[model samples]
Target: MEKLKPKLFSVMESYNGQQFIKDVTAGIIVAIIALPLSIALAIASGVSPERGLYTAIIAGFLVSFFGGSRVQIGGPTAAFVVIVYGIIQTHGFDGLVIATIMAGIILIAMGFLRFGSLIKFIPYTITTGFTGGIAVGIVAGQIKEFLGLDMGAVPSGFIEKIKIYSESLHTIDLSALLIGAISLGILIFWPKITDKIPGSLIAIIVSVLLVKSLNLQIDTIGSVYGEISASLPSFHIPEADFKTILQLIQPAFTIAILAGIESLLSCVVSDGMIGGKHRSNMELIGQGIGNVFSGLFGGIPATGAIARTAANVKNGGRTPIAGIIHAITLLLILLVLMPLAALIPLSVLAAVLMMVAYNMSGWRQFVELLKTSPKSDIIVLVATFLLTVFFDLVIAIEVGVVLSSFLFMKRMSEVTEVNGWKYVEDLTDEDYINDIENIKYKKVPQNAMVYEISGPMFFAAAHKFIDITVEGKVKKNVLIIRMRSVPSMDVTALRSIQKIHKTCKKQGITLLFAHVQNQPMSVMKKAGFDQLIGLNNFLPHTDDALARAEQLKCS
Candidate 1:
């Protein structure tokens, strides 16, 4: 319960009027930046533009009020576009809503289970790969609008989309194309002019004015998706059955995992900027609560948006109040200014998404990984990217994780080694000994040999131990096995140890154990390996194990 407490309460304790002013100012600015983006992302996600505002106002508010991070602004993000679009296309609006709610539940469970920190286990290569793939998908999805092509419906399949775009290339609307190009140009260069306002907002305003004043034949939001709804969202539950729940389980899990990863990543970035540590579990819970309400309010899945969070931090936001205010600002816009959004050209929104796709691509990191990372890492990176682009994010992540685990095991197996220790004379030097008692330790007895095992003794590396200690080792009157550096072992490794003991018994040679760590000792005792090897043979120190080995040699 202590870990689940929101950062808002703590920050409010020391909150001052000056900070409140700063928070309000920053919140308003971030809301301005979030407005056009929310619309663009919603359209991209195959939803009504108002639903995006609903998520921004509703989820954004809930996440801030209950979240762990002080400055993180929550809402719909580019990362969810592909997955959300696919869910809607396959399962319908109700299915999407149900899945989102389920995902929210899953996220809450994750937080309560303290699995938030485990999100970092997702490899960097996999994240970069999927992110770049998503960027490509976003860009492809926008081609029709960006070019103003004569297409009724765009296919979601990556290859099919390309084919459709190719067939429709001849039907490009010149007016829409010009508007899109100008919008993109402004988005790219507007930052040089001013930083007070967002480039996307400026681009949309300019494009809408140009299209409306010139009476150009172009597709505006109102022309395509109909009039923007100005009414507040009402709560409703999505219909779900056992069959639907079963069918949606996979997609819901995917959404939950993605939400957790993205939110935590955003929190981490914000933490670096503000020098504050966020409770990861609490953030997950906040995201869960936010998503549940977002779905109930007819909005899509939502998470922490890095760009919005960074904007919050840069604009003097140091607490959750800024996020809460940002949501209020969006709600006010939804009530008053939503009608103007209908006049904005779809092509301009598409242009805004194009810029978003470009920023989120992470192509620089991809290129760098390919150039510098190992072959195995590159393989995972490229494979995940291709799978995400050509197939699905779920498949990409599943395969990427399995492939990375196998590669990691292989590397671990390669590093784990068992070999005879021939440095006894080096240890016997007077200079290396601290006392006369230590210097008088017994040397290796005749026909007795000492072997050391290094690295974790897991299933993959167990074969190395078997190969080196059981099969390839020289015959001896007594054998001393040292495991000082070995931190842990699995059942397979324990079986391998048992095999070594059995082989020594068969050969009529004594087997001794030394410097066993606590975990391995527990495993050995549990598996009855200690009794089989004899309790006297288990020594706490290498010197004692060597003395026991010599005693066995004499016997």
Candidate 2:
């Protein structure tokens, strides 16, 4: 529970007026950076611009108040755009709400079950692959707005989108294209001038002003979505039938996984920036609470936005108070200034997302990985990337994880060795004191044979062990199995050994184990293998096992 405690409560012990001022200033700055981004991400996610603010205000507040990280700022991020859009298209906004709530529950349960650390097991290759795919997907999604292509209802799926966009190239509005190009140029170059204000915000302001002053025939948010609400969102309970819930389970799980991974990654980044440690499980709980409330308030899925969190840390925010203030600032803006957002050009937002996609693509890392990674890893990475682009994210993640697991097991099985030990070589000078006794010099009965087992004895290698031990034409009166190198054993391996013991007994031959490691010993003891093979035959070393084999031969 101590590890699950929120950083807000801990930071409150040293909270002061001076730090509060710093937090307030930092919070306001992050809110300014988040303003245009939230709107752009919301519109990109196939939801209204105001829903993004609702998410920033509600989820952001809850995550900051209850989260483990001192400087995490939570809101809708580019990563969720594709999945959210797909869910809304398939199941409607109500279905999305239900899925989000279920995802929140899953996150909370994961936190309680201490699965925070387990997320690290997700292979980096898979993450990189999917992230690149998502970047491409985001760029594709924005084409309709970016070029202001006059198309009748853009279709879903990557291939279908490309086909529709290609067919609508003739309808590109010159005004929208010019505004988009200008916004993109601003986003790319404005960072050279200053980092205090976000480039996206500047781009929006410049494009909106141009459209208004020139009376350009550009499609603004107002033209598309109508009048934007300038008030707080009203909470409503989401309702769904069991069948719908069951149907949406996969998407719900995907949302939970993305939220957990993104939030934890943000926490890690913020922790490094501030030189602080974060309680990951507590962060998951905070995210869970945030998403549940965000869904109820008509918002889409939300997670920790890395850019905003970094912005919070950079501007002297050292506590969760900054995050809280960020949410409050956005809320105030929503109440007073949200309607102005409608005047912003959609092309400008599309340009902002284009820049976002560029950053999120991680193309450099992907190329580097391809150049340096192992063949098996490259397979996983490429498979995940292709699946995400050509198929679905759910399929990509599921197949990627399964492929990684199988490849890992195959590699493990390859390294595992079960060898028959012949005459031991004379290397007394290099041998340890315990291994000084040479089996070559020892007088072993002619009817006895020794076999050595190495590496983990899991199900993957269990069959190999069995085939070598039990399927051979063994004329030996006794078998001495050396397991000093066997570090671990699974039930399948244990069952394999039991089968060997059974075959040896039926053939009137004795089975003896030498130097069994702790894990295998415990398994054998628990399964009564020691008693079944006779307790006296469980020797501590090869010499003892040889002595026992000699006795069995003499008997």
Candidate 3:
């Protein structure tokens, strides 16, 4: 009873006091912001507007209580629209439910396995690429309404979609385009004009009012979607087969990855604002549970909403109370105010989606990376971007990861190369090269050249050190390999050195090592490399090895 009493007290803490009122007000404002977005995203995902509300109400509340970050509002977001639409088009809503549920299970398992930290390994190029890609996809999906095309259904495949839109260009409805253009303009400029109110919602209201007062023959939710029921969600069980589950696995995995990335990114942002560290694994577990319940309740995909989360913080949200209130407010609106949304113009929704697409694109960062980043980074960025835009996001991510790794290995191999120069750096002239020789060694004598190698001597970079070992290149009879900089070695490099030694023996040349770092020394010693070279040939520093090399040259 004593333990339970304290827990009860903690729940009541956010409910009472002057802070409660502020929380309630902030939550209501956030709820208003979430209202149209939830429906817009749900519609974009090829589901009912009610599914978005259900997601905002159920998953939104549960995530608040169990999530790791403060002020993070969970609901259906623009990110999942493309995948959901594809899944629904291919497998129907039941398939979407199964995939969402399966994805939730995967998320929970990831949390229990403590894999939240692994999300950091997902390259930024891939994230940004797919994000911008999805944004474009969402905007593309909304084009029918944006341009008021008399199309029954939009195609899913990118090329086919473009072809359909291009062919349907003549069937444009001028009213829808005008409304959408005006709404998009308002969304873009409303913030600059005023920050006190939500621009998207305002645009929706104005667009709805304009059509209503002018009596324009514009299509609305009432005409197209009919009435939306506002109530609590009922649970549903999808009948799923192995083939369906298997087919869904790729998309399910995509959703899990996106959820993991977006949620944690939101957590990180909230942490920066509040100066707090969140329990990443716990948060993943919460997200999994939330998604599981959300799918069962006829909801679209849900994740942490960064905009609403930031709004919460800006509005004095400190704990989960604000998040809970946000959910509660959504519930009230769904129950009491949903039917009224029937007046909202589809064009306005499309305009909102366009603004969303525009906001999600980190164009400045993309341009900056192209300009300042290295060749490898730029390649990954551009490749990921093009693949995402032109092909499947799943393929883009998989290929992007593989490409990034290969590029990294190539760079490592380049960094491992050790070479010599003819003219030694006169310490006086070293200033001309800006003292790059400190991290590097300068030119030395032709015959007893001591090449120093540093960095990871793995197979990738290890092959480059052998340029000095090639036939007819060495001017020295006794060459010393100073491995003071090498931190490790692999079997490939070890075997390559053996082949180098055989070639050296053929040409009657000797090789030695000075201050061979402990790690590489142990590896070479274990590999019996020292036995082949003669144990006495290995010295502790450059001076001793150089003396022996000079002595051999003299002889």
Candidate 4:
């Protein structure tokens, strides 16, 4: 019950009129910034502009009200542009709504299962690769609008779309191009003038007025997608069958994972900015609920938008009230200003998204990784990037995770080793080794041998232990296998141990065990390895094992 508590509740304990004033100012500013972005992202995602506003109004409010982060702002983000567009192309609008709802259910399950902490296990290289890839995709998707190319419906395939754009290069509208260039320039330089207002909003306004007042023959949202809807979204469930549900499961899972990753990343960044801690599980739950409502309200998938969250933080917003206000601001605009939005040039929206692509691309980080990261890391990064751009995100992520896991295992295997204790001279603990050597000279009986196993004995490194202990040149009347440095073992290692015991018995050698850790001991006990090797043969230390060997030799 305590875990279900929202951060909003805690902030309200110290909340006051001063904080309310700050939050209101910040919320209104962020809402202005979010307006153009929401519409642009939705247009890029192959949906009507108002759906974006609906998501911002619904998902944004719900997430902030129930979220674990103090300053997170939830809405549709650039990361989902490619996936959402692809889903819409293949499955239609109803499919997308169903997929989003399914993704919401999955997110809720992830939170309840406490899988939030596991997000860190996703490698940085993979995230960077896919992010840059999505940037490329966004930029590619916007080219048709940005250039005002005379083409009917761009193909979803990356290469095919590029070819079509090239073919339509001769049909570019000069007026549209001029407006787009100006919009992009304003977006880039507007911050230099002032940060109080957003460049994107200004760009939309200027472009709309310029095209309309001048009577320029250019495509606007109304010209391309018909009139904009001002009414609030009605509640509805997408029609889905068993087969449709099964078909959507893969994509829904992808959405759930991406949403979880992006939202949590936003929360972590905001926490750092404000020196606060966020409840990861609660954040996931909030995102889940938000997405569910967003889907039901005919909105696209939504998550915590990092840029908007940062905006909220920079403007002195420290409570969920700011986020709630942002949603209300958008709602007010939807009701009052939506008609004006229809006249805004589509090229201007494209310019705004192109800017979004450049910001989120992290191209600088990509180049730095290529230059400085290890060969394996570079391979994963480059492979994931290429796969994401040339293919789809689903395949890229799947292959990237597997490739990283295998590379990790290979590196770990190289560090594990099995060798004779005589090599202990190489250890930095010379004093301990000298003491053991002196004791061995007096206490160790003749024809006794000791071997040490170091590091984890998993499948990849299990053979090293077998080769050193069972197939090595060392022969003795009694052998002591020391496992003090070994932390854990798997079934493969246990089988190898069994083989060594059999070989020692066949060769007329007495085998003893020493200093086994709790995990390995438990496995050995469960496998009956302890009884097979004999209880008397197991000792707490190498010295005790040596004493037991001497006793066995005498007996």
Tens-digit lDDT string for candidate 3 (9-111): 2445656667777777778888888888888998888888888999988888877877766667889888888888888999899989998988898988988
Candidate 2 least-lDDT 10 residues? 423-432
Per candidate, the number of residue pairs that clash is 0, 0, 2, 0
Tens digits of per-residue lDDT, candidate 2, 178-229, equal 9999999999999999999889989988998899899998899999999999
Candidate 3 ranges beyond 4 A from true positions: 1-22, 420-449, 468-480, 488-491, 497-555
For candidate 3, the 10 contiguous residues with the lowest summed lDDT are 1-10
* lDDT (Cα) of model 1: 0.90
Superposed on all Cα atoms, the candidates' RMSDs to the truth, in angstroms, are: 2.4, 2.4, 5.3, 2.8
Arranged by lDDT, best first: 1, 4, 2, 3
User: Which TM-score value belongs to model 4?
Assistant: 0.94
Model 1 spans with C-alpha error above 4 angstroms = 422-442, 469-475
lDDT, candidate 4, at 402: 96
The candidate with the higher lDDT, 3 or 4, is 4
Distance from true location, Cα of 335 in model 4, Å? 0.9
lDDT of 4 by residue, 414-463 (tens): 98977764422223456655687443343445557677788998998987
Query: Among these predicted structures, which one has the highest TM-score?
Result: 1
The C-alpha TM-scores of every prediction are 0.96, 0.94, 0.84, 0.94
Instruction: Give the TM-score (vs. native) of candidate 3.
Output: 0.84
Which of candidates 2 and 4 reaches a greater lDDT?
4
User: Candidate 4's error at 23, in angstroms?
Assistant: 1.8
